[model samples]
Target: MENIGVRAKELNETIVTLRRELHAHPELEHDLPFTESVVVRELAKLGLDELKPGLGQGHGVIATLRGKKPGKVLALRADMDALPIREETGLSFASTNGNMHACGHDAHIAMLLVAAKLLADAREELAGTVRFIFQPSEETVDGALSMIASGALENPAVDEIVGLHTGNLWEGLTPGQIGWKAGPMMASTSTLTIVFEGKGGHGATPHLTVDPIVIAAETISQLQTLVAREVSPFEPAVVTIGKISGGSAHNVIAGTCELRGMIRAFNQETDAFLKRRIRATAEGVAASMRGRATVMFSGDLAAVVNDKACALKMRDIAANALGEEWVKELALPSSGAEDFAYYLAKAPGAFFYHCSTFESSEGGAECNYPHHNSKFDVNESVLWTGAAAMAAYALHWQDRN
Candidate 1:
């Protein structure tokens, strides 16, 4: 395979162009028509004109680039949704509307689009087919499952899958630096919402009302102990309650209190244990306090477990293409959840992070904002590196398979 990293510098102009356009018109999950059109048009320019759009109900686009020789199918994925955050980056190309590319999906789309362009240009040098997956709703609904359900994983019969995210966790490194782990790289996520129903009465009447506010408080407190006491310390599990709403008036004993949160765990056993405990504690505590409780898991994302062999393959690619310094053994697990977990379950693959090197040392400008935060901004220099790494990986696989 030709050295893709050497050619990445030439595509820097394309990277900036695509990133700016994508960042300007940020779209939300399942509603990325404008962004999808941009991707489709650009992909068509790369000879992937025979496009398959609306794979995941209006947000997923799949395009094929057949190679000269027959080999296993390789799928390259990029998300196309933006967060609801108002862009604070102040860049000229920042999101014009309330939507912002705080999660770096803008970079993901641009990099992958460039990858398609590179692969298409190298079609004669390629050994196998390539599938470009532009996904939507990765932020909230985890649209990967929908794409898989719609047969995006079929036709080509995806032998291996690859994806990337731009985050500042490894702040000082340059764009091509790869962040990955052998197993359990990310925790599985389950959204838990519990509603407490209690009798309402005047605040002055102490015994007349079954105060749900009080029950909610108790339930949350006890729920904390579920992990500290029940689950093993060796296993990583986190239960967080982010939203709570109750009575409107201070003088009235509220009839209902709603609680919303998420449960994250590295293993399925720990996840199941936490769910069972949450249900039992919420219902049991509410019943004892003269209130009823209803609990349900709203949205779920399975844990991202990188296949061992695939992870090693990625490390080798990073070392060769980016250098030894850029490839490091990532031991820490990301507490966040990703829909890519769905893909790994179907086939052997790995989800790697592209270092969005930010100036974290300068306290005046906090560039390393966590995902889902309104102020999150990514270092744009990594755009070309991510594209190069992905394209190189694909080419390597093409040669080997």
Candidate 2:
């Protein structure tokens, strides 16, 4: 096959223009009517073999490009959800709809669309099929599972899968470089919702009142020690109390107090351990304070563990499509979580990081804010590298088989 780098570069402006359109009209989670339409529109022009719409119980689109022969199926996925944040990038194309693409899903959708175009143009000589998944609701951790339930993995039945994330999530990589890891690429996310119930009374009679607020505060403090005291120092974990709601008036003690937070870990065992400790501590603290407690887990996403063979193959293909120097191994696994873990549970796959970060010299520190932050943005210069590498991986995955 010819070098895909040159081809991707040729389509750079098209990719950028598409990304801007998606960025300006940001949407949240699985309800992606506009995002899905944009995806379907671009994919429909390619003359692909199959175009499935309205999967994931909402607006998830799947476009399949079948090669000359029937062989293995490789699915390339790109998430299409934005965070509930106001845009602060101040670019002409920045979203003004109150929702922002702070995590760069807009760029992900653009790169995948162009990559599908690249494959469709050369489908005659290709040996297998490429399934392009434009998924929604990644932030809520429900899109991938919902897609699978809708028979996304059926029909052709994907033999393998792959996805890529673009941003400054991983450090030590320059713009256009690719980051690959063999195992535990990302973390598990578990949400916690706790409520403490007790007797309410007038604030003047402190001794007669059973204060749920005090019990809730104690539970929060104990949760802070679960990672530091129980887990090994080498292992990484996090428990964040993001929200707390309780009393209404200063003169009266509320009957109940609620606390909401999130837990993150690199593996299932560690994640489970944290959950157990949190439940026990919250219950015990409430019981000791004469206030009953209720603890519930709302959602969970497992850690992303890459398939070793698939990872090695894609790394070499990226080195070939881009340059050897443009491909590098990541030193550490990220504590952040992704719902792509659900797809990996169904079949073997690997995730790659496309560096769209800007150095201080290029755009200053402000332009390179961490993902999910209000001011986050990507370096547009290297958008084609990710598209080229993904297209090249789909083209050459059969060689190793």
Top lDDT model: 2
Q: What is the C-alpha RMSD of each candidate to the true structure, in Å?
A: 2.2, 1.7
Candidate 2 global TM-score: 0.95
Give lDDT per model, in order: 0.84, 0.91
For candidate 1, what is the lDDT?
Answer: 0.84
Candidate 2 residue spans exceeding 4 A from truth:
none
lDDT of 1 by residue, 1-401 (tens): 46787677588788888889998999998898999889988987877635888779776899988888767888889988998888777777877799988888988999998888888878877777788888998988568987898787888799999998887653345545788778888889999999999999999995999998999999999999988999888888999999999998989999999999999998888898899999999999999998999999967778999888778888888678767877777768788888999998898899988887565454334667777677777777657778888887887865443
Predicted candidate 2 versus true structure: per-residue lDDT over 126-152, tens digit per residue: 778888898999888899998899877
**Distance from true position, residue 363, model 1, in Å?**
8.7
* Candidate 1: segments with Cα more than 4 A from true spot: 169-175, 360-365, 398-401
Give the range of the ten consecutive residues with the poorest summed lDDT in model 1: 357-366
lDDT: worst 10-residue window of model 2? 359-368
TM-score of each: 0.93, 0.95
